[model samples]
Target: MPGERTKYAWRSHILAERALVGAAEHAREAAELATAIEPLAGADDVVCAYVPIRGEPGDLRMLDALCVRNATVLLPVTGEPGPLSWARYEGPDSLRKARFGLLEPTTATLPPDTVATATTVLVPALAVDLRGVRLGRGAGYYDRTLGAVGDGTRLIAVVRDNELVDRLPEEPHDRRMGWAVTPGGGLRELGHELPVSPE
Candidate 1:
């Protein structure tokens, strides 16, 4: 369980760092992320995304950008510790305060398997390494949920530029991200050509 312990330490370090980010810098990065995420999907695509909470990267504007492209966007609806259910994100008005201090869409919920319908999923992460290994909060929601996605679906982690690292502790059940989008980096492919190594 050393990897799990390392993961927790990484989470603490990253969250502490995020907590110290200045409001001006956070806003600038959020605006940049909004622009970066704007063209990610189009009218034909169904995107599974999240509304950032705490010091997570991006903001409501990022989700709005996806809507502006006419993409059908789905947001996670949390329940018990298992795969996440989903709901359509209509707009800011459609969100209601939900469990875990999250703002979830008020729309009717869909099954966890609904994520399979998405062309892209914007996963929230504390950090993502060059090998596509993502460091998430200890919850296993995404680990369980991402398995439902069909092959070739883009599992893209959303993080700040510095949050993208060279390596991270990867667990056996951990699903790898195919791409990462940062405020400054836009989008970059991961793990494709890198030599695998133990962290």
Candidate 2:
């Protein structure tokens, strides 16, 4: 319960910071994030990725890049709070507004276990620490859904360059990210030491 309070405080602080990002800056970062994500795209890769909402670091360009490379992309379909179901991403036209202001695919839904098929899963995060701890929006969607990922699946947290911090609070139910991709930093492995400027 103590950690929950800390987690909520962290979420509030990070979200307030995200809210101040200007449109031009956000667009530039989105473009850079797309470039960082492009290298991971492959024709045979099945990627589980999310659409950016609020002031999240990435945009549709990231998904478009993966599609351009012919990778099969799956987006999360919201339902009752539990493991997230999925749906195939056919392109921009295939998406429709869903619960929580999320853009979900309109295609046939896939079971929660479908995430096991992904080669990589890019998740949205408010911040990620050197130890791979990811800070979400206090919703347990990712924490619950990620449990279904198969071994060897790359669990990557997508955040802005500055959002990568030196440390974050970790709860027992929190799944650790193996990697993080930032607009300016590209992709970096987690659970290792990285020089971080003092806050």
lDDT of 2: 0.91
Candidate 2 C-alpha lDDT tens digits along 1-199? 1334477787887888899999999999999999999889699999999999999988999999999999999999999999999999999999999989999999999999999999999999999988999999887999999998886999999998878888888889999999999989999999886566699
Superposed by TM-score, candidate 1 places the C-alpha of residue 146 at a distance from the truth, in angstroms, of 0.3
For each candidate in turn, the TM-score is 0.94, 0.93
* Cα lDDT tens digits for candidate 1, 1-199: 1335588788988999999998889989999999998998999999999999998988999999999999999999999999999999999999999999999999999999999999999999999988899999989999999999987799999999988888888889999999999999999999854566798
TM-score of 1: 0.94
Off by over 4 Å in 2: 1-5, 193-199
Residue 137 of model 2, lDDT score: 86
**Residue 169 in model 1: lDDT:** 89
Candidate 2 differs from the real structure by a C-alpha RMSD in angstroms, to one decimal, of 3.5
The runs of at least 3 residues in candidate 1 whose Cα sits more than 4 Å from the true structure, single-residue gaps closed, are 1-5, 192-199
Clashing pairs in 1: none
